[model samples]
Target: MALILLADVGSTWTKLTAVDSNGSIVGQASAPTTVGTDIMEGFNSALSEIRGQTGSKEYSIYACSSAAGGLGMIACGLVPELTGQAAKLAVLGAGAKVLQVYGYNLNEDDLKEIDDLRPDILLLAGGTDGGNKKILLENTQALADKVSPLPIVLAGNRNAIHQGSEILSRAGFSVEVTSNVMPELNRLDIEPAREAIRNLFMSHIVKAKGMETLSRRLAAPLIPTPAAVLAAGKLLAQEMGELLLVDIGGATTDVYSYGGIETPAGMVRKGIVPPWDMRTVEADIGMRYSLQSLVEQAGRENILAQAPHQEQWRQELDKILTYPNRLVSPGLEGLEIIIAQWAVRISVQRHAGSMERVYTPAGATDVLSGKDLRGMNTVIGVGGVMVNSPDPKGILTMDSKGLLPEKPRLMLDSKYIMAAAGLLAGSEPRVARRMLAESLAAL
Candidate 1:
């Protein structure tokens, strides 16, 4: 049978899925990520498992990766609020870990930090079409002095791209010029920058350490794992109106919200420029690797409220933190489930904007600063704990404290299909949509 293969090379585990050409999911397999050795070993193992299960070896593969700590990115813009924030959002929206963000022109300390961070790619954006050339060029020249070999995506003032490119090129840096991320005052255009980041992910990231062979074997451009998730989430939201995607992993809990038609008043009231999609990564709120930080951030009370044995669980977590690879008996599954609940609860709250009353000269008014997710209709859960848990729905019900989505239906990506569907979205949108609908149906 003709088949399509999709995989996500994640930090801890590599998930692989096989789908028939008709958009039906066929087989799914996973293996511990082989980061210590050749990372391709994990892929080989997963592919072999998939072939063995499906009883065939003939298939085309598409993949995305969050291995090697994913892609690290830094964006520099002229203004702190307008263009700079847009650049930062674009970087996050593209699934890169934000190493640092510089709103104003780069100084000595900033350059030193960028060099220390050693981001895989740097995004430089500022000004509108014909506005603010001085700061863009000033920032460009400053970058030329320090960031010698880094690949810079020049997405600033339209009029200054050429000059910026020339300066950076002369300084021995590779420059990819894209349209301004903030082409106008209240207009944010991030597609070009997002595409640039993806190109770098495929061209530079996947092939960086020792995976050249794996990179060459892939048929499609390898996307950042979060980007693939976002792509699949966006498509799902298109079909199901507004939707929220919660993915809880070992190291991070990522929330992707696709606000399609139904939007909160915050989008207009806060002067949000081109508000449609949002992706937030809560680094301190994961289940395994970040349990300590999660506890520190979410507080002990929040976790105990979920009905988990507190003291013994805390001791196990302490051991797990130090000896991460120790295969503990699976008796702590109850605590794990409670951790998942906190991950979803806090990550969603962080991803969403809050409504605050402002005391202005004109009567008191309310304003929002982030993407409001209260209007989303469904919360789709993806990951092992989310899909496997019997009461994933209960965890997803979210405490009634924050600006919660009212009566939103709960869905689960039971087949581990979100990342795979995201990888297939660009080439075979029909297959992606069909696979998502087939497996991730509402509960």
Candidate 2:
């Protein structure tokens, strides 16, 4: 029987799934991601194990990577609400983590911080098609003088693109110019920027990570793991309808929503209307790497209220904070669950749109801001915490703000095949859809 190999090389682990041509998941394995050396070392180690289970050597290999800490990016725009947010959305959609999003010109301190962060790409976006050009000009000049030759994606005002691109290119920075992210106020044109970032990831970031060696072995070009997940979410939404996917990871929690939204009867939407397909990454909230930040956001008192043994849990929390990767004992898994609960709570709250009362001349009118996921009837949970937890569904049912589906069906990505299925979605829709249905049905 013909076989296919799908893999996701994550920061901490390299997971692989083997599936027959019939779309049956045959075997799976993983190893520590050795991006410190050659990434292929970990991949080979995992492949060796999979070989023992499936005894397959000749299979079509498809892979994506979140290794080398994924793609880090800094976005500069003219205004925080308009251009800045547009830039951020474009970066997130392209599967890059926004290290920082700066509005107006880049100051000395901002440049220094950018140096420290050492992002893979710098997305310079601001103004509209023919709007303010001064900020883009100033930021480009500052970047040329202060920043290293990191790739810069210029998606700002049409009036500034030529000058900005010239400034950066002359400074030895590789520049890709695309249409403005915000062509007009409240009108986002981010797809071109997103495509530019993805192309840079393939051309530049992959080489920087020394993934070129492994890229040659894949059936197709490598894609960012988060992008794969987002693709999978979109594909699944096509068949299953509108849904919200919450992916909790070691360092961040990413939420993706698909399908059109309906505004409440009398409520008016304020600010930018989020895309029908949208993704928001909560960098501060996570179970492991960002545990400290998660605790700080959830508050110690709030977290302790859920703990049966507060003092004991404090000591465990300290250890998890320090090591971040330390394995949790069976007895202490409850703490992880509690942490996961908060992670889900805080993340979904941020992901879901909110409404507030605004007194108008006529009467009190409600204004809604952000994506309204209330119409969603499905919530899919991925990540180690949810997959390993005994009560994964229970964790998602705690809708603190009534923003989630009123009574939703909760599904867990137990095999963590979302990314893998995503890698196949573009080329093998039948296989991808079957994999998604099978995995979700397993729950």
Top TM-score prediction, candidate number: 2
Please, what are the lDDT tens digits per residue for candidate 1 over residues 13-45?
888999988888888899988888888888889
lDDT of 2 at 354: 79
- TM per candidate comes to 0.92, 0.94
Tens digits of per-residue lDDT, candidate 2, 1-443, equal: 65899989998899999998767898899999988888889989999999999988888999888887788898888889989998999999988888999998788999999988888998999888888999999999998999888999999999999999999999999999999988888777778998898888888876334478878878977888888999999898988889888898888999899853567889888777787778899999988888899999999788778878898888888888899879776698778888888898888888888788899899999888777777776889987778878878767766635456666688898777999999998899888888887888433
Model 2 regions more than 4 Å off: 207-210, 400-402
- Cα lDDT over the full model 2: 0.86
What ranges in model 1 sit over 4 Å off? 207-210, 260-268, 305-310, 321-331, 359-364, 400-402
Residue 126's C-alpha lDDT in candidate 2? Answer: 86
**For each candidate, what is the lDDT?**
0.81, 0.86
Score candidate 1 by lDDT. Answer: 0.81
Residue 418 of model 2 has an lDDT of 91
